[model samples]
Target chain A: MDSSASPLSHPFDNAIRLTGSNGHYQGQTTAPYANMVGPFGGVLAGVMLKAVLQHPQCQGEPVALTVNFLAPVADGDFTVDAKAVRTNRSTQHWYVELSQQGQVALTATAVFATRRETWSAPQTPYPGAPRSESVPAMPKVPGLPGFFANYDLRLVRGGIAPMPQAEARLPHCSDTLLWARDNPPRPLDFPALAALSDIFFPRLFVRRQGPALIGTVSMNIIFHADANTLARQGEQYLLGEARAHRFYNGYFDQSAELWSSDGELLVTTNQVVYYKE
Target chain B: MDSSASPLSHPFDNAIRLTGSNGHYQGQTTAPYANMVGPFGGVLAGVMLKAVLQHPQCQGEPVALTVNFLAPVADGDFTVDAKAVRTNRSTQHWYVELSQQGQVALTATAVFATRRETWSAPQTPYPGAPRSESVPAMPKVPGLPGFFANYDLRLVRGGIAPMPQAEARLPHCSDTLLWARDNPPRPLDFPALAALSDIFFPRLFVRRQGPALIGTVSMNIIFHADANTLARQGEQYLLGEARAHRFYNGYFDQSAELWSSDGELLVTTNQVVYYKE
Candidate 1:
C-alpha cells in the first residue's frame, strides 16, 4: 500500500491544518480519518457520534446516537464541530455540523448519556442465540474491493469466497456466516465499535448478478452489553447473519446479526443499501 | 370532530398557516419553517428532490429519489429551493435544500434521468393483498405524535387493527403486507409524494414501551416506476415486513416489503430505526 495515496488519508482529512484551516484543528480532523466515508450526506456524523460519547461531560453511560440526515454533504474539505448544547450530571446534548470547504453539508445536534462510576449494577443481557466458536481467523482483505479493507474478515460458512460468485442470493432459509474484526483492536470504545458499523456483511446472501453493486450509508448499533468485554475475550472474529431484507424501488434494508465467537450474540445491525444492479 | 379545534387535518396536504408565520414564505426568509420539530426536515429533502425533477429545461419524466439522514436537523425553519444544476435532454442534475435556517436542515442535490416519452408501456405490479374496497380510513397519524394536526390519515386497513406480537426472531419466510393512506385525498403530485417521506412510519412497529426512545431520523425512498402511475393507484396503503434487523447500540436497519391493497407491491422500504427499546 502506498503511504501517501492510501484511501485512509481522505482529501477532507488532509486539508486540516495543525492550528486552523478556516475553522478546525489538525487533531480533530484525524479523529474521523478512521472511517473515511461518514454516515450520510457525506458528513462524518457516524464518527461524530463516537466522538460525542467520548466527551468528558457525560456522567451515566453513552449508549446510542441517532443522526437525522438533513442534507447532501458537498464534496470538498470540511469540518465537523460540536458544542455541548445542554449538560448536567447525567446527560448532555451536543450540536454539531459539517461544513464543506466552508459551506454546511450536514448538521447534527444530539444528546448523550454519561457513565456514573459510583453506580453499581447487575449485568446480563437477553439470552441471545448461542455464539459460534468455529469462526476462523480474520483475513487481511485490504482495500481489495471485496471487503472494503477497514476490517479483517474470515469466511466461515457463506462468503462469496471467490470474489465474483458471492453475488448470488442464497435460498430464503439458507443463511451465511462470516467473522469480522477491526485492525488494532482496543477496549471496544463506542466510537471505535460504531465505526466498525461497516464490518459485518451477512447480506452477501442477497446475491446480485452483474457487478458488485451495493454500498451502505449509515448504521445504528444497540449496545446490549458492555462492549469492553470484547478485549478480554481475546478473540476477534464475530459471526453475523442477515436476517431479513426488502427491496423496493432501487433500495433495500438488510437486518443482520453480529455474534462473538464465544456464543454471545453481541450486536444486531440494520442498514439500508443502494445497489445499482 | 370540532372543526377548527381539530387535530384532524391531513399532514400530507398543503398545510394552511394557523398564524401567518414568516418561515412559510420566501424573500424575507429563505427557510421553510421550524424544521427540526416539524416533519419538514425529512420532507424538505424529498420536496427538493421532486422540485429538481420538475425544473424547467428538461423533460418531466419521473426519476426516483432516496434521502439518507446524516444528522439531526437544526432548530428553526429553512428554505427548500431547487434548480437544475446541470441539464440536457437525457439526464439532469438538480440541486435542492432547506437552507438559511440554522444552516441547511435538509438538502438534496441529485440527477434526474429524462428520456423522450416513448410508446405507452405495459404495467404489472404484484397482486397486492386484498383490503376493503372503500374502508373507513383511520384518522391520519400525522407527523409523529405532537406534529399531527398538520395531516390526517385514513387507515385503508379499515379500522383500528391489532399490533402484531413481538418476535425475537423474524418469520422464516419472506411475506409482508399492510395498509395506509394520507387523509384528504390531495392531488398526487411529485411534491406531494415527496412529502410522504414523513408519512412512512417504519418505527411504529417497534415503539418503545416507555418514553425513553428515539425514532427513525433518516429514510430513503426509491421510486421504481413513474409518479403518475403510483398516484393513479389512489391513496396507496403501505404494507411492509422486515427481512432482518441487527440490533446494536440502539440502532437497526430493517428491510421490508411495501405493497398496495390490490396486492400490488407498491414499493419496498428500507429504514434504519434509532431507538432505546
Candidate 2:
C-alpha cells in the first residue's frame, strides 16, 4: 500500500538486520521498538529467523518456528549464528542462537517447507467478535512496553487495565480477543506475522489484578498459510485470540492463534512462561 | 509390574540406544519396528533425543522438544550428531541430527530445565471416556507399522479397523482416545514419554477409510510432569487423546495429550503431517 516506502527501509527490517561474515551476524537493538527488557520477542524472533532466511543455504517458506529464551537480552549489540542442520528435497531444519558478550541469551529452531495444494478443512471456528473499525485502539501510556506504540491494537474482550489503573480492577479471565495491524501499515509477511505472534500481553496480567515479573521461556508456532495468502491480505487487521490452559511450577502454557479477518487461520502459536511474585 | 526385567533390557531402551564418542553417535534400525517407509517416527524421535540425553554434557530434564523430519531414513545404520547449543544456570538447549550415508535425514532441538515446586493447575478437563481396562487392545496384524507391537494400545473411540478389516468399516471422525503403556512396563521418563507422544495412528486414517501416504514433517512437545510425577505412575497406562484441527494443502496439524490416570497432564504434543494420494 505504501509503494514509496521500500521494505528495506522499514523499521522492522532495520531492527532485524544482520551484518557480519563467517556464519556470524551482528545486529543492534532499536528503541521505540523495545519491550520491557529488550527488543520485542517477536522482533527478536524475526531477527533469529532473518538470520536463516538470509543465509546462503536457506530454502523454502517457514512453516514452523520455536524460540527458547535462556536469559534476558541486554539492549545493545548482539550476534546471531544460524546453521542449517538438515536439508531434504522439500524441507529444511535450522538452529539459531542469539548472544551478547559471548553469552547465549536465546536459542531457536525453524522448519521450512514447500507446500502443494490439497484438500483443506479448518475445524476451529472463527470467533463471534466485532470488527476492527468498530473498536477504539488501545491508548499508549508511559511505563508500558514501548513496542505497543508500533501497532494498532483494538481489544474486543478480556483486556487488562492500564498500568496506573491496574490496581483498580483485575480481569476475571485470561482469554483475550483483539484486532491488530501494524501502524503505517505494511504488507503481511512471515517476519511481520512472526513478530505479531508475541504481541499479546502476558496472560498473568490478564488474570491477576496485580503485576508480576514474567517472561516467555519457550515458544513454538505452526504456520498454515502460504506467502500468497498472507500478501493478499496486505495492510488489513488480523484477528488474534489467546488463553492459558495451565499454570504450574512457576511456569504456564499459553496458546494463541492469528487469523485473517475473513477467517483463514494463519498461525497457531504456543508458549511456556516463567512468572515470579 | 515385572521386577525381574531391568529397564536397560527393555525393547524400547534397546531401540533407542546409540554408540559413539563426543557428540556423534551411531544407531541401527530394528525389525518389527519399521513404519511404512522407514523406522517409526516415534522411535526416530526418541533416538535423536537419546543422542542428547546420552551426551557427556547433557544436563537437567526435558522441558520442551521439537523434532523436524527432514527426510526418510533407510532401514539400516544411521549417525547422529548432538551439540549443547547453550547452557544456563537452570536450563540447557541442544541440537541433534540423524543422518545416513553422510546426508541429513532428521534434525531436532531440545530444551532441558530444572523445574521447581510451584502453584499448579490443569484447566483441560480429563476426558469422560471409559477407563482403558474396559477397552480391547488393538490387535497386531500384517501390513500395519510393525512398531505398533512396541506398546500396548487400547482404543476407546475413533479407531480405524485393522489393515485386514480396514475396508470393513472406517471411523466417521478424526478423533482418537486410547490407553497406552510400554509393553515391558518401563518407568516413564522424558525419552520414553517423547516416543509415546507420537504413538497415535494418523488422524487421516481415522477419518478416511483407506490410507494415503503420510509423514510427520514437524513435531513440538511440552512436558508438564516432573521425574517424580512420571515415576509415581510407574508402568501404568496413560490416557492418550488426539484430534486434528485443520487439514490443508498437503499438510494437516494434529494435537494430542497424554494424561496419567490420576488426572495429571504429562505432555501436550502437536505436529504437522504431509499427506499425498
Candidate 3:
C-alpha cells in the first residue's frame, strides 16, 4: 500500500483541525494526542503554525518557530490568534497566541521565507544505524501516554527503561537515538515534522531513570527542508538523535537533529524544560 | 586593578541604555557596537532583554530569549516596547518589539523564571582549550567591524582567514573554538552575557573560507547560569565553541555552547542565517 495515498484520515489531522477565519481560529484537544496534564506540546505547536499557514496574509514557508508554553492548557476548546507583524520582501514575521477560557496558554513566533537555489551542504554526519526493518518496534505499554501510540518508534540506543540500582546512583549521560515515523504510516508534512520534533521524552526522565515533575518552557525548531524535500520523505522513518547539554538549578536544555532516511538533515531543534526534584 | 570595580562605564551598558518606563522606552544605536549593517545583533538582543528587565512588573531572571531580526536596523534612535504578556507564579512571559521611524525592526520573546535548588549536572563534556592567559589576543584589523574592537578574542581554531584555492574547492567543516570577553574588562551581567551569546561569526565565513552576503534571521539563547553565577565570572574570558549542523538551500543553522574558564556551561545558542551565494 502507498502510505502517502492512504484514504483514512490521520489522527494528526483531526487533532490540529481548526475552524473560523481572518487570523482567529478555534480548536479543541483530542484524546488521541493527550499528554499527562495537557495536549501534547508538539500538537499545540502544530496548531500554532497552522493558524499562520491558514492566514491570508502569511507569506513563504516556515524557517524558524519559537513556542513558549505559558500555562497548562485545559482539555477543551482553544483560540489561536495569528498576526503577521511584519512582511518583508523575502521573509515574513508572525506572532501567534493560543488562549483557553480567555486566558493565555501559549505564545509563539515564526519566520517564513521563500527559498532559492544556493550553496548547500551538511556538516554534521549522519550516525550509523541498522535498517529500520531489523529493529524491533517499541511495544505499546498499557499505561503510557496516548500520544506515544501515535508514533512507531524503534530505539537504537538510550531507551528510557529504569536503570539498575548501582547504575542509577552514578552520574549518567543523557542521549537518545531512534528511528521514528507516524504510526499507520501517514505521509510526511511540515506540521507532522513540527510535532515530531517534540517527540523526545524530557531529558530529566531519560537521565534520572524515573519520573519527576517537568514542563517545557520554550522550544525552537528550525526547518531546513522545503515542501518538496519533505514530500520526498513520504512515510519513511527519520533518524532522530537528541542529547542534553546541562541540567542546572531547576532547568535543563536539550538539542535534537532529525535526518531523512536518505541522509538529509530535515530539522534542528532546541528546547528548555523546567523540572522540580 | 579590580576590573569589576572599574569606575569607567562599559560600552555594552551605553549601547543597551534606555529611558522611559511602563513597558515602553527609547534607545539608540551606539558607534562602538556597530556591525557591518546595523548595530550588532547581540547588543540589540541585550537591549530587548533590558527593556523587560527594567519593567516594573518583571518577575524573575531570564531563562530563554528568542530574537527575530526582521529588517535592517538603520542607525539612529529606536523604540523598544516590552510587555509582560503573562506573569505566572514561577515564570513570566514577555513580548518585546523594537521599532524605528514607526516601523518594526525586530521582535523578541523572552521567558524569565524564579529558580530554586535542584539536582544539577553537565552531560556534554567541555572541549579542551588553552588557558586564556596562554593565548595571544586577536589583533584588530583595519577593516573589521567596530564591534570586533569591543571584545578581546583569542582563537584556538577555525579562524575565518581565507583558505588556498585548491583547499577551498572541497567541502570544509565549520567549527570555532575561542576565548572571549569584554575588551575593557567590564563586570559580567545578564545583559552582557546576552550580548556575548551572539559573538560567533557567521558559520558561512568559516566554511567557505571567504565572505558571503549573509544575515542572521533568527537567534535563540538559553541561559544556564543565574545572576550569582555570572557575577562569579566577572571580567573573565569564556570558552566559546560553535559549529554548523547543516547548510541547505539559501539558509543554514548553527549551534554554540559558551563555557566559563572553569568549564561550567554558561549558555547554549542556536541561529539560522540567510545567505546569497
Candidate 4:
C-alpha cells in the first residue's frame, strides 16, 4: 500500500477488514501488522473499534474505549463479536471480543457519544516538542515486531535501545517524546488513533535496559478531538508524550498524550503493563 | 448494617448482593444507596464487579476494571449477566451487563490477574493529606442524593458547596482532597474500592457554581495494591485526591488517586463525564 493511496484502499483498512454474519465478524491477520506474539496491540485495539463502528446498529463516534489483552493472540484467522448492548438518544455502549481457536483472546468495551457544541477547554499544556525535521528518524531494527516497519518514528527524547553503541545512559525518567505517523500515511480516524495509542514502547524499556516478559494488561483511551480535527491532520506527524509513574509487583502503569502538530489534543491514553524480569 | 459489624454482615455486602442461578444474577436497588436519579455510579460499578467475583468460574483477584454507564438506570430489580469470556492459568477476562426492563443500562469489562512476588516500586509520592481528625466532616445537606449518607467525607480543600452562604469563592482549581470512608465502616476490598472510585463530586460542580445535568460516560480504575494491603487497611479512612486536565465541548475528564491513611497507593482512577448546562 502506497502512502498516497486513498483511505478506502489503505492497508490498514484491509488489515482490519471483517466479514460479518449474524453480528459475528471474521478477519485475517496480516503480516505487516504482526507483533512479536501476534497482531500489534494497537492494531488489535483499532480493529476492535472498527468492529463496533462497522456494526449495523452502531451510532455516533467513539469517545472512550477500554481493551483488555487477556492472552496472546496467535497469527491466523480471528473472530470478533461486537454487540451494541445499549443505545440511548445521545450515546451508545458496545462490548467486543476477539477470539482465536475458539477461545477469547481480547475483550473490550467502548462508549460512543454524539458531540454538541458547548463550553470547552484543554488543560494539559502541549509538549512543544521539536519539529519532526529536528529529530532523526529511528533506525528500523531487524527481528523486532513485524509492525515496527509500519510506523515512522522520530525520537525527540528517551530513545533507549537501538542506540549507536555510544552515548548510552540509563534513562533518567521513563518519559518519551516522539513524533509518529503511520507508514502508508493513513488519514487520522478512530481506528488510526486507536492504533497509535499504544505506539510507545514499554515504559520499562524506556527506563531500564534489556528485555523482559512484558504484556499490556489493560489500556484505556479517550478521544479528545473530533472527526474534523483528525481529518485536517491527515498523514501529518503527531507529537506524542509518554511517561510512567509506578512499576511494582510485576506491573506498572503509564499515561500518554497525543497532540496534533498544531497543538490540538488528539487523545489521552493510559495502560498497565505486566513485566517478568 | 452497623459500622462495627463483621465484613460478612456489612451493609455494603447487602447492597451489592445478587441471587443467581446458572450464571445470571438478579439484584435490586436499595434506598440507602440511591443517587440523584438512580443508584450511585460507584455502587453500580461495585455491583457489576460483584457479579464477576461471585461467578463460580471467577479465576483471580481483579487488577483492572472499566465500567460504562450506558443509560440512566431506574430503581427496580435488575439482572446482571457475567461471562468469563476467557480464562488462562494466570488471568481471566470478563464482560458484564446490567439490564432493566430488558434494556441494557450498564456494561463493563474486567481483567483479573494471579499475582507473584517480583520487583516493586511506587513512583507517585504520597500526598500527605491532613489527618482526618483535623478536618471537619461534610454536613449532610437536605435534598441531596440519598447515597450521600453512605460515606463519611472529611474535606481538607475543594469544599465548594454546602457552605453557609459565606466563605464561598469561585474554585481556582478543579482539585479535591479529603479523607473518605464507608459510613458503615465496611472492610476494604475490591468492590468497596470500586465503589469509592466514583466518590468525588463532578468536577463541573467543583469548578463552577450551580447545577448541571452531569453523567459519567466512562470510568477506568487500576488497582495498585494487593489483597493483603487492602485487608490490612480495613475500615480505615483513605486519602483521596482528584483533579481534571480538560473540560471541553460538553465533556471533561479527571484523574484520581486513592491512598491508605498511612500513605500506601491503593488505586488510580480516571473518568470522562458528560455535562449539559
Interface RMSD for all numbered candidates:
10.1, 1.9, 0.7, 1.4
Q: DockQ of each model against the real complex?
A: 0.08, 0.53, 0.82, 0.66
Best by lDDT: 3
Q: Give the CA lDDT, 0 to 100, for residue A119 in model 2.
A: 67
Candidate 2 Cα outliers beyond 4 Å, as residue runs: A1-8, A20-24, A141-143, A162-173, B1-8, B162-173
Each prediction's total of clashing residue pairs, residues at least 3 apart in sequence or on different chains, is 61, 0, 0, 0
lDDT of 1 by residue, A1-277 (tens): 1122335544332322222333232123332233324332212544455345445544444343333233344333445665564454444545455555555444444444533233121122323332334434445433433224445555544444444224333433224456555533334444444445545442433333123444443334443334455664453555556533344344444555565656554554444444443
CAPRI level of candidate 4? medium
Pairs of colliding residues, candidate 3: none
Order of candidates by lDDT, top first?
Answer: 3, 4, 2, 1
The numbered model that scores best in DockQ is 3
Q: What local lDDT score does residue B213 receive in model 1, on the 0 to 100 scale?
A: 46
lDDT (Cα, tens digit) per residue for candidate 3, span B101-181: 898989999999999988899989999798989887776555568998899988877776632121322358788888999
lDDT tens digits by residue: candidate 1, B42-133: 34554455445444454544343444343455433434455554344444444344445444444343434432333221122343444544
Candidate 1: what's its TM-score on chain B?
Answer: 0.63
> Which candidate gets the maximum TM-score versus the true structure?
3
List ranges where model 4 is wrong by over 4 Å: A1-8, A163-172, B1-8, B162-172
lDDT of 4 at B228: 94
Local accuracy of candidate 3 as per-residue lDDT tens digits, A227-273 = 99998999999999889999999999989999999989999999999
**Candidate ranking (DockQ, best to worst):** 3, 4, 2, 1
